[model samples]
Target: MKVDAISNDTAYYFLRQLGLERFNVKNLNAGHCAKARSWESKKAKGAWSMSRYAEPDENGEVEGVDGQNNNVAYLSRSNGNSPTEQLKKIGLSANKFTFLRMMRGSTLRALVPYLNKEQLLLAMRLFPKMLLVRLIGSLPKDMLLKMILHTIPLKKFLALFKAKVLFSIVANKRLNVREMVNGLEHLPREELQRLMTNITGSDTTQLNKPELLGMFRELDKLQLMNGLRKMGQEHFLEFVYQVTKKDPQLLMALPRGELMKVVNSMPKPTLVELFNLLPKSQLEQFVSMLPYKALLVALYQIDNKTMESLLVNQFPDLIAALAGDGLEAA
Candidate 1:
């Protein structure tokens, strides 16, 4: 049936009637669409409408006339078999059929703002089987349907539907923190660390103490402390004091290349913290020794707009800070 067939008043009234009867408002609306489509499709093939009958068959079986059955009446099966058996053989479960009808109806309503009555109706007719497969053959159909509904402009419909469906799904299946951390493995080191901090509920300034300690233990066991040191001083110190408790042997064993590498890999915030920990002379020397590339990298740690303003004003100290390392001439 065309979406336009169900006027707002009609839809509102239908929903109200369902609410009065204590049926789930969303489910009732979905069932209404299913009923409408079944009616329309049967009418298209010159079959009797449900309004003309008391109820569907008690056996959940379709009515038959010689070779024809109500449920499979539209299909022209070449094989000689009962229609119910044929439907079962094709894996058409009751829940799937119900979900198929609901998606078709929801899609129709979702397209109402963007489509004319004719286009909406045509899409409604075409999409049911595809939606059914996408819903049933993969993840939960309700989740997929909710995602589709969200992308559409039908916010009121989606709100009612989502309040009844999606909220429960998310609550039941909370996202895994470990899985979220592992998912960041391919990201750039700074980005990966940022994502890991976000996943573990750590702020940019303070790492998750427990999770970070655990991660450090793993890295230490793998003998990657040198690699960790090369990530930068803030990372190293944080790992040392916060995680490994400043183990003397571990500190002594750290190679200079590893320290530099870790420093280079640090996010700007952590780098700034490293700079803050250095004595004035050491900080000046470190800043002076930084290549233009390293200085540019450090600049990324600061806010972008602030950096832009700093560049525009040609701050002499900032320029001096970036000089040396042979890259100053370039």
Candidate 2:
């Protein structure tokens, strides 16, 4: 006489509706009373009825069930408890139960639009576990449920839900290692260094080149290059090479200020040599940082109008560099 053994869809429908605010017990089939009585008779002398209308146990706690038989038994045996009280004994809040019951009658799709993005994400994560548990628990008395239940703990099922959420968030490109690193900034320096090392080593080996590149792109978007640079030349060069190899265009598109900072930090002789090697377009961008005296000296050596045109016409950097030095020296 297990409640689950009953296969009547009408019976389940009638019981599920008990949670509904407007649902009336009087509307259920009259024959359900005999079924409820049979269920009650199966219980041991002092065993609790699934219907909670009877007196509570030694702990003064009532247990209730949801379904037509239990609802019918509750209605017949009530010691003046209201329907709301009866529903509460079964661990369901009146309003939530009402919504659940309504969902059974109407389409659940209508309720989906009302859920926010976070709520939707939460549902997506939890629903699968819920379904899995139901599936495992509902296996026939063929010992399948018992065997599976022994092997899979409920906590593992919950962990699977969290793993699913993480996978979904990461798979969609909305989350990545760099963002995760930035989030851990407040941790100890040693912890941060260890975390970065582990992430870089594992990601570089575990992920394909394209996936690693996307991760680096996310890091750049989060402005974490400075932190990466601070990690040391070896780490920085590795990072730079990885990024540059994947996207040469990104280096060309770097912000002028950041590019200047990187250039200025290089050794003076190397900086000068690198500056000389840049294309005319890139070289023109550095006109502001070039020492005016150095330019004037270099200008005398150049046989081209490009140098003169930049120095005479667009030389704010040249002017500032020159002005910073006395006219006597110029």
Candidate 3:
């Protein structure tokens, strides 16, 4: 299954269907609910700390509890023969949720290999972003490749490229440069062009597009990120535009001033297209970013049909309210 097989439409539909289901209290298992509540109480009491294992010595070895390292000692209690055995022992020793709650992010990362696909997906959704970063980093390079190529949708997977996440992964020395490059290689050529131009600070005019992209293979994630930082706002705006073209709502992720600047730079026609592309949920935010004068100007340029579509399709209540007020005035 190629990544392309899992279309954004399919993923969006799956998530939408999931969202459509209503919660039913009757479906809850009383035993499981009590256990969950107990986990929460323990969490609130700070009983979840991962301090059972001794701190490592200067040599990075924890003292002789069978000579296991800091990473393994707690999970195995210095007894288990393998990581799977260690995981099984730990799981058996306490409430499953409580045991998980006590595990550090790194320990959870170490457990990823023992998890099946459903378990991995659950971990991905439920883990905190910081912990997910570590868990994702811990995945074997080939496994990560397989997930990107066959499991995750392109749009959903690319959301991991946020600056903080990438910076943290690089800072922790967990970034797999080849894997990162391979992912980039899978992006559309136009996107790759925009990204490489920003990273290299050389447009297609300065270097052959392919030659510039070739440099991407030699760069590590850190350098690629730093190059983006040094690329200046203009290029960064273009990069953002390229990345968010299919999902205009993502433009809101930019700083308000930066987002306004990017939107303001567009011609009236382009701005109209952007407004049309934006989801209804984000319409208020997009409008809020524009000054009154700019907003009126952009709105004035939209044709009557487009304006009606925007009003009816994106703001049905607003249109109805305006019509009601017009009738009252009449």
Best by TM-score: 3
For each candidate, give its TM-score against the true structure: 0.16, 0.18, 0.22
User: Model 1, range 86-133, lDDT digits (tens) per residue?
Assistant: 333332221222222222222222213332332222222222233323
| Pairs with steric clashes in candidate 3 | none
- The C-alpha local distance difference test score for the whole of candidate 2 amounts to 0.31
Clashing pairs in 1: 229-258, 230-258, 230-261, 230-262, 231-262, 231-263, 232-262, 232-263
lDDT (tens digit, per residue) of candidate 2 on 186-242: 344444444345445542434444444455455543344334434543333333334
Counted clashes in each candidate structure: 8, 1, 0
Candidate 3's TM-score: 0.22
| Quality of model 3 by C-alpha lDDT | 0.36
Q: Is candidate 1 or candidate 2 better by lDDT?
A: 2
Question: What is the Cα-based TM-score of model 2?
Answer: 0.18
Which sections of candidate 3 miss by over 4 Å? 1-163, 170-172, 206-210, 228-330
Candidate 1 lDDT (Cα, 0 to 1):
0.30
Clashes of 2: 1
Per-model root-mean-square deviation over C-alphas: 31.8, 36.9, 26.5
Which prediction has more favorable TM-score, 1 or 2?
Answer: 2
